[model samples]
Target: MLRVGVVGVGNMGRHHARIYSELSKEGEVEFVGVADANLERAKEVASQFKTKAFGDYRELIGRVDAVSIAVPTSLHKQVALEFIENGVSVLVEKPIAESIESAQEIIRAAKKNNVTLMVGHVERFNPGVLKLKEILDENLIGKVVTLTAKRVGPLPPQIKDVGVIIDLAVHDIDVMSFLLERNVRKVYARAGSAKNPLELEDYAIIMLDFENATGVVETNWLTPHKVRTLSVVGTEGIAELNYITQKLILYNHEWVKEAKVQFKEPLRNELEHFVECVKKEEKPLVNGEEGLHALMVAIKALESANKDEAIDVEFT
Candidate 1:
């Protein structure tokens, strides 16, 4: 059995621990333990999962074959490097790192240690998204011409380190890239901090130009009700995905078809995939390079918003 632990048992991290603990009963994985800077929070979550708790993540370095890092964006690099340096595989939460430099550093460390590195772009595992990809791959949409996503909800109490672009819009940015299978050529964005107490943009519109398609992402923390949706317009028809409900619909001039999808908890799927990768020594779907590319686009959108101009996206 592959041994695993979770670092930072906060909102998302606690769910990670729960899933690992549940999976452990099947004998496929061993839920080792959890670590958090907040000792009480760590202890509480470890108790729920029936595992030990550590005050410092360093305590888990040599004990597990892999770990899921769900600390804040700022501490991602520091925590990820420690585990990677100890030859442990890691699955870090989205945005990879606060900046591209730190993301590169983590990627370099993972490579040097020869460990499996995965990024938790959980949306990729959503049933709707997976079905949408299948339909697109089969040319049901007939060459995507444009894509648009709207993800808006009230401010999350746990988010204090980043703005809407990084925390919210980055999801769509990565999804758009995944669907189109191309890098963003340019980004034009506008953002504001209306109603948000923090000095971060709570509302933003980002436009992305890909080699073959145009995309728009609308994200905000001002909506009273949560909304997570994506629409694709192609030469033949339009496809819509409701992320929350995991529903997909395809529309054409002659007919309308609703896709049938088997929904699974995205987090469980993601973590299971991470374990399979570790056991078989395979590359994860959302690898470090993919995470870095998404981060680059999000950073460029932020720059565009700050400068009030369109910015070119460069990949190194």
Candidate 2:
């Protein structure tokens, strides 16, 4: 069995620890422990999971075979590198890292050590998104011309390291690319801050130009209620997906069809996939390169907003 541990049991990481604990109890992986900078918080989560706790994440280095690192975006490279250098596979949360340089650094170290590096782009594991992929692959919608997503809600207290583009839009940016199977050629974005205490942008509209299609994402934190949805318009039909409900609808010139979808926790699916990949000695669905590509597109989107012009994605 794979010995797994988690670092940073905060908003996102707590769930990782919980799921790992469940998987361990279910005879999948052995959940070694959890770590956090806050000793008290680490103890609390470890108590909840019935596992050991580490005040310092480095303590988990040699004990576990793989780790799920849910630290802040800025600390991703550091925490992940620690495990990688120790011959432990790591699954770091989304955006990979704060900048292109750090992301590349993590990727390089993973390659050098021959470690399995995974990024927690967990939305791709959503049942609704999986169903949408099936519909697209089956050509239920013809050539996709435009794909738009709306992901808006009040800002989580846990988000302090990044703005809406990096914090929120990256999900859709990665999803759009995954669905369209194309790389962003150019990116343009408009963003501003209203409610964020740190003055980070709370709302953004990003436009991504792919080789044959266009992708748009509306993300914000000022909304009173959450709304997570995606719309795909193609030559022959249009599709809509409700992320929260895991519902999908397709509309063509002939009829409107509601497709049945299995609802599962995205985080559990993501962690399960990570566990299986490690067990089978295989690559994760969202590997380091895919994570880096999404990060590059996100950086370009931010740059596009700052310069008020579309930026070409040549950095990737």
| Candidate that scores best on lDDT | 1
TM-score per model over all chains: 0.99, 0.98
- The 10-residue segment of model 1 with minimum total lDDT is 191-200
lDDT tens per residue, model 1, 1-316: 8999999999999999999998898888999999999999999999988999999999997789999999999999999999999999999999899999999999999999999999999998898999999999999979899999999999998999999899989899999999999989999999989988887999999999999999999999999999999999999999999999999999999999999989889888899999999999999999999999999999999999999999999986
Model 1: per-residue Cα lDDT at residue 117: 95
1-316: candidate 2 lDDT, tens digit per residue: 8999999999999999999999989999999999999999999999999999999999998899999999999999888888999999999999899999999999999999998999999999999999999999999889999999999999899999899889888899889989988788899999889989999999999999999899999999999899999999999999999999999999999999999998999999999999888888898889988898899988888888889999999745
> Model 2 — TM-score against the truth?
0.98
Worst 10 residues of 2 by lDDT: 307-316
Record all residue pairs in model 1 with backbone atoms less than 3 Å apart, i.e. clashing: none
Q: Once model 1 is optimally superposed onto the true structure by TM-score, how far is the C-alpha of residue 256 displaced, in angstroms?
A: 0.9
